[model samples]
Target: MTPTDPGQQGPLVEPVPGAPAAVATLHDERALVIADYHAGYEAGLRIERGVDVPSKAESRRERLLSLLERTSVGRLIVCGDLMHSIGDPGGAERGELEVLFESLPSKLSVTLVKGNHDGAIGAWLEGCEIVPGSGTRVADVGVCHGHTWPAREVLESRVVCLGHEHPCVRLEDEVGGSRVEPAWLRGRLEPAAFRGRDEYAGLEWLEGDPARTGSRPVESPAIVVLPAFNELVGGTWINVAGQSFLAPFLPAGIARGEAYLLDGTRLGPYRSV
Candidate 1:
């Protein structure tokens, strides 16, 4: 489906060719949007898997800086997972973030939609806008971290963007070799899954709000699930059997899910791909 018209709606998002980022226009400001940065991920790998690899913080920072320059966006919107640690981010991770932010133009605004991995980021980060993990609505676009149900306001937008699944696909050749590639998942929201009691519990229907009582959702916004910006992290293999989505509302919330490669190759239905 086509993105919301830039002239009619106050927001528009266009994915950069061969890139993990998208340029979005929110109101009058243009922003570069990315997700699951997972800064200092190498440190996590060392601690969790005993793989002591050298840090790639400089490269990650430079990559982001290059994107900002190429896109010429005035704002940066990180959907979530700006930090690798869930709590008490140490000096290295915090230092990487500081240097990264310092490297950006002083005029560029930054917005971080707090993710499950960013529970304590605010304790050290500064000068950036941090929205609730439930989600936030900026103009006609909705953004969330995708670990839980988005706010009702976010669900009602013309389009919803999220990360956390870090979706990927496995490609196998006739020679029995295979490779994993990052992928983008796009679909329309299924109203039944969000509204039904059994499908997802504790979803706020806002039934107590007199204005919203008994009022079904007015729209089924298109949903865009982003690939992780950090390549070192693991991902959910959407095309693999027995693989399940990490988001609580996903799989059930999506309709006609389609996958696309970073180079813009359409892979048709994600399940079949």
Candidate 2:
């Protein structure tokens, strides 16, 4: 799929060659952001489905290398859930994780945002820096694994990138059949909606530290919820009525945001489903 055009002036984040639930590559930062790698997905299938699939470490590694080669990015920012199991990873899962990271170029800087499913993820990656539970910032962008409240620093960015909801859309055919496809959700944050909530802390902190953002105007930032990188996991259809969002910061009680297909199709106003 073609990369989606990020039509903004500063600190642009665009969907890269991997699409329909792919990597989010930063144009200005020369960095690549991906979510929900779930490295040992085959292990889950083995346990749950009673089906034995070989470890996908080599294939997944090769795929990621191709994306890096395409983007030529020096940094890889994993939003979260690099592994599937929230508890201890099985032997196959651990081996896969080791193989994947070991294959990465030593020159690359890899950052992982702690996700709810990432219990003691550091045991696998000895030196990689894992951001706090709230998330971290890179230039004018904020990155998080989603599942929880973002830290005050994450709000300073003009754009906030997150994962964990595995956002998607359900499309119904005229024949009354429906299918789900991974999608990107882009929407502006309403500051008023955050009032009295923990998320409003970031906004409040920005109030006192007006100089924190330097020259960039600290307007309400846009939220970009990424689709899962691994297709094995199911998704939450953002357009489906009465669907509960995993992230507390999401639009409350409203059909909102635009959904884009992996091939750069603008699904438009996701609220309409």
Report the C-alpha lDDT of model 1 over 1-273, residue by residue, as the tens digit: 233333454437778878888887787888888999998888888877899989999999998999999999999999999999888877788888999988998999999999999977887799899999988988778999999888877875778889999999998999999999999898888776777444334444311233656655444677888889998897999999899899998898988888988888888899999
lDDT of each: 0.84, 0.75
- Flag regions of model 1 displaced more than 4 Å: 1-11, 197-219
Tens digits of lDDT, candidate 2, 81-166:
98888888888888888888788889988889988878888866664789865798887678888788787677776677888889
lDDT of 2 at 194: 56
Total clashing pairs for each candidate: 0, 1
Q: Using Cα atoms with residue i matched to residue i, what is each candidate's TM-score against the true structure?
A: 0.89, 0.84
For model 1, the run of ten residues with the poorest summed lDDT:
199-208
Superposition error at 261 for model 2 (Å): 0.5
**Regions more than 4 Å wrong, model 2:** 1-8, 18-28, 48-55, 198-218, 253-256
